[model samples]
Target: MEQTIQKRLPVGGDSWVTVDVYGEPDTPGLVVVPGVMSDAHTWRHVAGSVDAWPSVVVVNRRGRAPSGALTNSYSLRTEIEDLGVVLDEFDSARTLFGWSYGGLITLLAANERPIPQVIAYEPVMRPFGRHALPDLKVAEGTADWDRCVEIVNRQISGFSAAHVDGLRADPHSWATLRRLSGPLYAELSALNAEPPPDLMAQQAEQADLIIGQRNRGTAPYGTSFDHVRQHVVHAEVHELPGQGHLAHIQAPAELGHLLNNLAAI
Candidate 1:
């Protein structure tokens, strides 16, 4: 449970902010990359469970909490560079676990560095079929902070209004989200304009992809496996039944077990 925060020296003139190392220093290094609008704290439960590991780095992407300065360029290349800065700080090739948008970042980084191992959970594939460009625009245009609150409230409409209020009242979660780069919404909006087929192909050549069977964002949830099976040669895929996008949060024990075993491999 030892906690420390340190600011990374500037990478390419941009400071990369991150949290301190967690767990034993001699254990295998494990890096957790959080999703868009999320920070290192989102991995608290997962990191705590794996504290037996020699080292763990929970990264806060640029423009996110514990980090500073939003880059106008929200391209995957920029994200990959950010990851490179973090990887440079580590002594050994490490296992990376990324969720949602963070999964995309992980994929790009693995493609660039050939890291020993990677575990990505339900990454958002660009050009999400039915949820295309126009839909993204609408979602973006309506995503003002106040509107975001409304959307969350409506999505959780079944809950009593008071309960929804309580959820929003949770300062930590909201604080973490507030640090998200405003351009992220725009970047997401531009998804349909350009599908990441190139990036997908790159990912297929690197890192193992972990998919949740019930995840609705990606086609088949298992489709990429078939495409990547031959190309990656050593990549592994795991499917968790009855699970969705938030599987890491909903099934931390199972996810942790999977990652722990992968680290051994």
Candidate 2:
């Protein structure tokens, strides 16, 4: 296994963001951006499996860091700005590999700033319809965080009851999900209030749209891909056979192989 190096880059204020780098220097860089409630650690297996072990940087987005305080607010624009900082900090010829919410962030960021290529895995872009951004809010400004997390897993991500139960039984996994609820809440609110971005207007010359075959039958995902197929220019679709939304976690080797193939192009 390759050694992973962690570095912190200042994102202004007193806040700093971390990136985990793997593989050799002076190689084409791959920036792995995780979905909501996720951090750099989630991509470790995938990064390690990349062919030839080209440089890979996995980012620890705000609020998902294992240590340090999170940013006070969340918004589409702010997230893009943070990504901009990461790009500058890494400073390499790069491709953006984004999963779910991170994919959505890449879509928007690529519009504002051009990147070499983007591979988006089931980006949570409500191109076809809105996600059920449930109002878990209370009068006193509290929320049923656990309930919201369950809703996201069940309704949005299409996890089964057994799957949810298994997650609950895993103390580390459950704790990470709970910790993500707040930022997830903020991100959902921002997405619901603002209109979805126009896919046709995206600046990237190449976009590899990846979807799990199992995900095609799931809610919003099926329709979301339909919209992407019709409109997104310079787009090519890749289906991960028998996988679902969590392909990166469930099949990291497969994901890594696919990424390595793209980088070889």
Candidate 3:
């Protein structure tokens, strides 16, 4: 294994963001985009699990404490540009793997600025049925970070009470979930209020859609794929057994296998 190095790139507004680079510079470029409440560290395992590990760039989106400060001008466009900057840092074909909210970002960014390829896991679509979107108003009204974290874990992620309790018991785990409540809320707000740009053609001809077999989040992914199928010439859907929405974190080895295989295409 090679030592991972940190790199920074300047986006608009004079704000600098960061990425953790791994593998050799000559290999194919793989950029990992994390979902809400996550940073570059969240993808550490997946990046490490890659076979012979290619050049991987794990990005820390805005509001992640390790990368940069959350600015007042935050929006989906800014986030898209942030990922684009990281891709520009590398000099090879950029293959993107995004999970959950990051999946949404990947699809949206590909539409605006087509990348070599994109693999999305459960991109956010208007939930399954009638469940309301995570209420930004509720998050705004509540000052208690713990409570806010609970709401998202349960209502949005569909985690059980026991899972929430276990998360709370671990100080590090609880802090990871609670630390970015503001950014998570902001992301939810954008999801509710805005729709991403539409795809014109098959921007990603060889895209892969990986989801968990038992994950309830699969429905939204299906909906998302249905909408984008016409614009995607070759989209294959695969499922990871015994995993859920956070499969990338829960089953890094298997997820990494799938991702690495996609990169080989």
Candidate 4:
């Protein structure tokens, strides 16, 4: 097994963030912000495959395990500040990679501070149709992880019944997804509650938006891709053949290759 370097930084008096450091530390590398239900532990495989940078700094954002809990005051700003902390401290993290919700944060963070290079994969930039958060919240409140997982997979993720069943059949995957559901409720609720962020002020010099070919034309994700192409200057969209939203997990090497190419520019 490859080694992972871990660092925990206190964000505020109450909140904390942990980062998994992979690759060489001799130089600044790409900083990765993960999705709604993932942190360093879950992102390990994908982070490992990305060798285009000197290091891979994956942020374990709030609401996820190994990081602080979602405080009553947690909001989008909290997520940005946590990411900003990593960016401010890590001078090597001049480029950023964001997945799903993390992609949204990457764009938002670029707005606050100009990033030299930014890449986002299927960011839920605009709140899509109903996530049934009320139901998901109730399930979470009662510790009904299974129900919570089902709702998120079917509703938030747009997974088919068969897909959900397959996930449930895999004990290991299901267990991780269930654990992640605890934080999913709060994060999705925050995404749904906030009005669409102002993309006009985003300041990335180079930006790339990636969408899975299988995920194209999907309601929420489709519009999100369009939104980025429409709003972000120099934003280019790339579709991965034979893939879906989970490409980072399903095809990390391929995704890493694509990112490396994007960075080569």
Measured against the true structure, the TM-scores of the candidates, in listed sequence, are 0.73, 0.87, 0.87, 0.93
| Root-mean-square deviation of candidate 2 | 2.7
Residue-wise lDDT of candidate 1 within 163-233, one digit each (tens)?
55665688865544443534455444432245454443253333666777775344433443344334444
**lDDT scores in order:** 0.59, 0.72, 0.71, 0.79
Q: What's the true lDDT of residue 46 in model 1?
A: 71
By summed lDDT, the worst window of 10 consecutive residues in model 2 runs over 131-140
By lDDT, the better pick of 1 and 2 is 2
Candidate numbers, best TM-score first, in rank order: 4, 2, 3, 1
Backbone clashes under 3 angstroms, per model: 2, 0, 0, 1
TM-score of 2: 0.87
Worst 10 residues of 1 by lDDT: 150-159
Instruction: Please list the Cα RMSD from the true structure of every candidate, rounded to 1 decimal place.
Output: 4.8, 2.7, 2.8, 1.9
For candidate 1, the TM-score is: 0.73
Return the lDDT, model 3, position 65. 63
Write the residue-wise lDDT of candidate 4 on 161-237 in tens digits.
99899999999999988888788777876776666555632788888889889878766676666765566666877
Residue lDDT tens for model 2, 1-265: 3645788877744577788888765566888888776777877898889754368888788766653444565566667888889888776746888887788777777787777788888876653223445443431146566776687777666778998899899988898777777666666665565666555427776888889998784666766666655556778888888887777789999988888887777
Q: lDDT tens string, model 3, 99-185? A: 877877787777766667888887664322224334545665675678778877777666789999998999988888788675766
Q: Candidate 1: which stretches are off by over 4 Å?
A: 1-5, 12-15, 24-27, 129-143, 149-183, 186-206, 216-234
For candidate 2, the lDDT comes to 0.72
